[model samples]
Target chain A: MGALHEGHLSLIRMAAAENHRVVVSVYVNPTQFGVHEDLDSYPKTWETDCGMLKDLDKELAEDGNNLGGIAAVFAPTTDTMYPSGRPDQAVNAKGSFVTITPVGEVLEGASRPTFFRGVATVCMKLFNIVMPEKVYFGQKDVQQTVVIKKMVKDFCMNTEVVVGDTQRAPDGLALSSRNVYLGTRRRKVATVLSKILRVAEMSYLREHRLRDELLGPAEQLTKLLLMEQHQLPPEERVNFEIDYISLADPETMQELDEVDETRGAIISGAVKMLPVEVPQPGEDLGLSDGPPVRLIDNIILKPVKL
Target chain B: MGALHEGHLSLIRMAAAENHRVVVSVYVNPTQFGVHEDLDSYPKTWETDCGMLKDLDKELAEDGNNLGGIAAVFAPTTDTMYPSGRPDQAVNAKGSFVTITPVGEVLEGASRPTFFRGVATVCMKLFNIVMPEKVYFGQKDVQQTVVIKKMVKDFCMNTEVVVGDTQRAPDGLALSSRNVYLGTRRRKVATVLSKILRVAEMSYLREHRLRDELLGPAEQLTKLLLMEQHQLPPEERVNFEIDYISLADPETMQELDEVDETRGAIISGAVKMLPVEVPQPGEDLGLSDGPPVRLIDNIILKPVKL
Candidate 1:
């Protein structure tokens, strides 16, 4: 999926630094999207994406590095990705699919049941097609990184998975293609996702190791945000729905009641931003109508000797 | 899986001929077996298996072929194949699994629902680990060959899949490790699987293209075999249970009501052999007492101009 944002660019840049030739696969795998998810509305900035890649290559050339900059951009069509015809987004939809469970069945997968199934299946296909020695993924989708790693390990795929730190806005909103769907007000509110994760991270860093202690403030802040929105004038209010605030084992993605002192843990969450009412005739405040803009972010807690 | 029967040898020899080195995986994949299926009883002639490979290498050396004999035998432990712990054999068992549907769902799949899922999953792991230029499968497992090919194509796997002709005993019985469990009487009747497939193949070659017309004689022969077995004395009888007699498209594994003359089809079936009585103290006939020994075989019809 390519809107060529700063986040995607970071992964590409990282890949270029490591490998001599990097193949970028720009595919909005339909199999990965849920029936109601943003397959149609998902950004497709092809011309801009290509231009950005070219610009990145020029920038790398200027850097005087021996590393190759983007050898080929594999922009395959839906037809190429799913030659057996596009897979049905429904959970039970049949065809060729790769599924990783336990890890895939929690959090994001629990919310969007078939989401990781689609992700794993597409990633496997891409891995086979590109056959890259190393693959890069943004930590923005933390659980996705875990799922892919597990799939690669479990399937014995001869590819290394590299994780790039999440790129964020000045407000700490995780950079995402879906971010474009956020209206002005919703955009401001979406940062709450990353905010809560940070709060949990700060708590964990302060040695508040108990699961409840770590997640308590984050949950409280989410509730307070909802309450504050409820008190606002209905038309001006933005509804915030917190999907999950998870402190999980990074390897298995299994919810951890308490983070292992040595292994640490990943604190992550998803929040949906929805405008209470469509922007009035006088005010077009950049509010979307169909589905809420779901924002997700995560923080990795390093192990502490304490 | 390493009983090292002629069928397995054929695949190994074919692979050796095509590639510089051949890695033989001899793990009895537990994931592929159903819970009640013979996971425990399934033969584990590892020492004999290695001996056979060595013997094959000697023969290859004697042949003066430039092709390398067995270079390595990758006999991974169960823990190695399923690092996240062994996957449960139950249908709904969750883990990382690769599934090819439609093709994987019909024919043999319908009989053993999760059979192809395990096959596809394990094959993916093996392909990734070995990264072979070409892989080989014996045509004795016709449906399995189809499933693996579809998985490779669907996943865009790099390796080419080559099908070795089914190796058979003098009686036209497809050679299989499971044959050893058939005992003497059951072994004789097990040949019925291949015989019926040959009947269907002969019918197709003679231009008897109609579905029922082609299957009629073959099915009648099976029924006649069962009737004959029924007429035998209780101690002498061997049970013949036909799981299925399928005339299916070679590509999709979908049952074909009528053979597609141009595209051709596969004639296949599975027959279970069960001894009616336990071996008495005096009677030392080689008859098994546990679950029926299932034997499968198939014949491919070449597409005809007429």
Candidate 2:
């Protein structure tokens, strides 16, 4: 969880501005990853992460404003987090677990069944450990923000959940530690996730509230990308697979047929990128074998006075 | 949960004596009750419950010692507890829930599968809502205390869990709101639950550490009760059904084949009572119809310096 990208920094900065003290919890949280997903491959830049936090603190201090800097960093071992035993990655794994239903079982959760359970469980543990007055999350993971909010509301936890705006690259790719996994070509193509969400956002801004109207162009663009890749020579093709494109109620994460004018909605999606041919020896092509690199992004539609 | 018997009062008194403020929550959490269980029939003497708390506060105030009294009573409705629709009574019901495993799946949990899930979930909600420094539970519910302790440790909750000794009647029957359901004849027989637990406790103190040695007499007593009821005339018999008698590790709630003298153990059991015949018109015989009135009790074996 601690690659220390701009997205993570944004939340930290927001927390620093508001609270007298800020504690950052940097945990990979194994329970959230599916067995087949990239737990081992997930980035762990502890030294660089600390350096980044230090730099951010110095910058805040240099600004000559009274604001809280990093008070401490909570980097717990696996044993400390789970004293009983590590939770099984299986959906029905037997152990102490916190689960949010219906809200957690769609989109990302639907794709990776045990993910939200792991996220909710770990977050609950962290909240208890830190006992913070406020917790911050990046809107990059939209459904996760919704799930955590629901957990806090339903469980009556005292901490407030603050969502920071998603930080993005100049090319429009959402900032993520997993972004390092993208090879050169795949990196270029990765922006399509944000591109499609923007497409959906543009349609929403145009007052196209119907599900089909909002998602049509985005779906068509994904199909076109696949079509273009298939037309290329097999060895030259860069494959794309869209997992889901959701227009959903922000509170419940329920897929919506039409956006509510009063509450607005969130348009989110996930896509996988793969190279068709295995890389030759000494090849510099950015290609990965086995599981494809999955990227997700979302956009929030503010309620409009219609 | 608001019958306010001696068992509940002991916990309240303990809390008042220890902390500067004590908050008693009185909600018969629906999620904890199975559809066939006593959700509707469970006692709800709110006025009387408040009266008892008031009486206890007055007594605490008269002691002239510096101690806390009842600061507030949190009595949330089902809708307040479950903002999303109330969780289905089914085990696999779809909704937000907290689950503790292995520990929650044995002894009482094995008999009532969904019981601990409801308990863990509701306690989590209450803990978050109250955020008390310490929470009190009666040891009459041995498995519940163990499960809650595990949840607090595993979740890293801040509240210290305090267990009050099980308050009992002069005849050794554990005080419970459900005792009202026992008829005069069945009420006398109800003492068998504590009697069996005491039997196991006595054997443990005698260094009968093996499972069979410790539980043999207790189980035999239950068997004898059932046997004696069978020998009685059909209409005259007050039936006794032994659900389970467990000698378990107090920490994990795992059934132990042999008690570890250093760690000690807990001996607990549940028994169901039924009146074998319908009550005649104008009869005031203390008997109930429909589902059996189940009673549970337990005793702790102190760790021996072996």
Candidate 3:
């Protein structure tokens, strides 16, 4: 609720403009997280969320916008969201990965096995309860948005899915709710991710080959992004496990062994931060329990043909 | 299509009475039966089924009855019904079993685990294809009617299910297509199944405990109905394979251990006729595969409170 950022605003504004009644559900569903994942620390600011909506409503109202069309904001309790959501019907079971059938078993399915199922189930529940005609998501969560669109089509749902542009900071860092967790210095270097991707996109326009031409620069940029942004050294790259970084077919989301010009390619990546040890003398490895290493961040690059 | 009977006529009549455009689907869905169950030898009376409908239409027309409502008859090919009905997506994998769901796993779930699934799935495909507002069924398949009703409610289906009373012969043999395989003498003894249930109904009305008091008289009546009325011996009663005989809650179709005055009961049963012994000298005991022994019948009884 507190992050009254432009990226979130864009989604709300688009929904308001396009749909008959716009519903902004500000819930960070806990079911999509793994047991060690950050469910408790996820940023939520109801007052700020409400304030942003009120400001938008005032602006729209002054501009002769029908404020009634922008329906009530939905902030559901965790009880309502996760009730009977567990697979075994057990109460307060640890978090599960959200998985979607067929699609969830391939590509992203490989990394977050239960991810898409949790997502599809929760979305279906929300859709059934809300009965929304149109739902909005920012392009920042590109893979999630795509997964949802595919789910709606396959299940024959009536809702229209609208994906807004990924809003970026002035330095070109992708806007995120978790971006608030970055320190002041770490925040500036985070922009390198988008900047390096832009360079890669421009280089791909001039070349067609992957093996000898684009692979070296792409690999270098990937390493540079992790090192420069996360402040992790080359030795730490081994611990900062890169799950997969590859070019794939954009439509079916199937990883391409060889690049084809006819079909578009998506360059996506994911990594888990290795568990860090606190420097203490004879500290029992099991005694001091630090937070578990978490999986985060994904990027997508579409090839440009000049 | 030779077994032209009144049971089939009742379905047609109910369909004509209910809808502006009635489509009577007469296909014997192959997926509903188990491998050992009757599939090949079952009667296929297309000519007679059509003739009976036409004759009923004419008779109703002459009698100034409302019978002009019959619009079409849908007798689809077997391939269309089972194209994707099985659990194995590989064999008839056109996306069969689309209709049935977890709801089919309840009452009929035990005896025919896949039966209700096949029924519901085929019915859904038929319903979608025909776009019918109303569908008809005979009361003889009471469990099937109940299963379908539950499926429709669970799936939020729009079609109305109308059940016609079971049509029976003068001696009380419930009409069925499989009855065609019975010889003249066996067909006479078949009526004993219904007559025994009729006495059971009388016993229930006399405030007799079914299992404790009524089973003796019911079994005796069954033997008497077989011997005196149809000229069969007492040993023939034991030869008839009885599947299940129980009173159940009419709504949920759950078996009630003890009958209550407020709730009604359904007395249902199935029997396998004795196989003929064909002589095989010095080889093995030969059981001649006399006609299909898969005979089923049921009678519903309401409680008479003092």
Candidate 4:
């Protein structure tokens, strides 16, 4: 997970600000990806990532009294991390592995079934390896942050888990490593993800409608808005789809039947972008020369809004 | 896991002797048991466990330089540990939980499918809560000890998992919590578990037959030996049964297809003993007052003989 976007940098900056020492792990965990998922195509810019880390360290140390700096970077190979060998055929792996139970089955997990199991397992391994006093994560992956928090608490792990606010592009698209997948034209339109969620948030605040009832329509409306607002030609709009838009109780991650007066909610969604492709003479990029890349973004909607 | 026999005490003593402080957790973890297993009938002797611990500390302290003392006893309630709630229906439990995959599926795990998952998860939870420098386990539960070692190494847990030599009674029956289930008569025959394993270990050393070929007849020979050695009346022998007998790789917990002369093997077995009734006439002791208690024991057969 090492393409070092501002969102990840924010967590690093926060960790540097808060802790005396920091260690960042930069490995694309393989177990987390399904057989058909983007294990191969996912970004890997280790050199750039290290340069950014060095810059951030210099920047942090330069801030007068800001003393925290990265102590190390754990970049383990697949063989080193999974000594039982690759988890491709997990059932036969010789090592003892970690899994997060039911919490791994909702929302994001529903879309990517094995996602949190991989996240929780790797995080636990990282926590053990680094033995950190505190850990930080970006809030863009709200479900993932929550799942890690549960693992820390349930396991009684010593480190504190801190969630930093999600960083965003100038146009408001959540900063993500996958953002590289967006074509120049689609990248401009990527802001639609947060825009749609913000719209749902405003609607929930004004209407006080049950989340379940509201989110379903909000998802459908986002499609209409995409068509009308983008003013894209029919051919350009052909392969686009909104995977899911959900309003769920933040901690439990269960989709709320209705928003009560007290507890707030989290609005999350994933979208597949059909962007202008970089044409190759012989290659088909599957849906208009742009690989169908899934981008996820989320925002918290405080139910008792002031 | 609170029966606190010599096997458990040996581990506690080892932990105390080696580390600066020792904490013994006595909760009977519910997740590790199957619905039909003996979770309900499992023994809980908290007071006696504490008494033994206090006695061990005094014995260790009296020897004068054993600086490590009991700093805490983290006997958490089910609610305290699994804040996500009890793992009664683990699949849907809200809190994050841990699992040690494949290794949990070999050998003992093959018989008790969910057993090692429960063991790995709880041990991780305990490791987090205790944050120990070193952890200890009796070698009697060889498979459990092996699974935990894999977890510690794989996850990079900070603590060292030290395996203590298995402790036994004067008669050489491996001490276990379930031994309490044996009525006086069957308790006498309960030694059969270790007795059979001892014979197998000797046979393994004496004969170089392939493990799979040898173990099958070794098991059949144990039943014959049990009848001949005890010379039990046919009435008493009817209720006893051999659950499984295996020769396995100690590290992987995989049943060895054949033994390599460089690395030895572990001879393990479990036997269910149905003893004479506890003689409370009107009590209606459903399964004939003598509980069907399953006891497990094992021995390491080093290939290089003197």
Off by over 4 Å in 4: A65-67, A89-95, A207-209, A226-238, A275-289, A303-306, B65-67, B89-95, B207-209, B225-238, B275-288, B303-306
In CAPRI terms, where does candidate 4 land?
medium
- DockQ for each numbered candidate: 0.86, 0.82, 0.10, 0.62
Per-residue lDDT over A160-237 for candidate 3, one digit per residue giving the tens place of the 0 to 100 score: 888888788787777776665543333444454455455555556775546335445766876776665356553222
Which model scores highest in DockQ?
1
Q: Cα deviation of B70 in candidate 3 (Å)?
A: 1.0
Better of 1 and 4 by lDDT: 1
lDDT of 2 at A239: 81
Q: Give one digit per residue, the lDDT tens place, for model 1 in B1-306.
A: 788888888787777676778888888888888877888888888899989999988876676653777889999987888888888999999899999888888877887888888888888888888888898888888888998998888888898999999898999998888777766667767788887878888888788998998899998998888898889887777888898998888898888888878999988888877754745555434423445678888888889876
| lDDT computed for candidate 4 | 0.76
* lDDT of predicted model 3: 0.59
- The sequence of per-residue lDDT tens digits that candidate 4 reaches over residues B1-306 is 787887877787777777788888888998888767888778777888888888887887886666687777778898887787777633334445555656677667777877877888889889888878888888888889988998888887888889889888898888878766665557776787787777667666676658755575567777686667457554444356778888887677677878765678888888877654334344332333567787888898766754
Put down candidate 4 lDDT per residue, A1-306, tens digits, no spaces. 898988887888888887888888899998788767888888889999999999988888888665588878889998777776666723233344555656678777887877787788888888888888888888999999888888888888888989899898878998888877765556766777788888787777686668655676577668687677457564344345788888888777787778764778888988887644344355333433467778899988775755
Model 1 scores a C-alpha lDDT of 0.85
lDDT of 2 by residue, A240-288 (tens): 8888999999899899999998999999999987653655455445423
DockQ-best of 1 and 3: 1
For all predicted structures, in order, the TM-scores are: 0.96, 0.96, 0.59, 0.91
Candidate 2 vs 3: which has more TM-score: 2
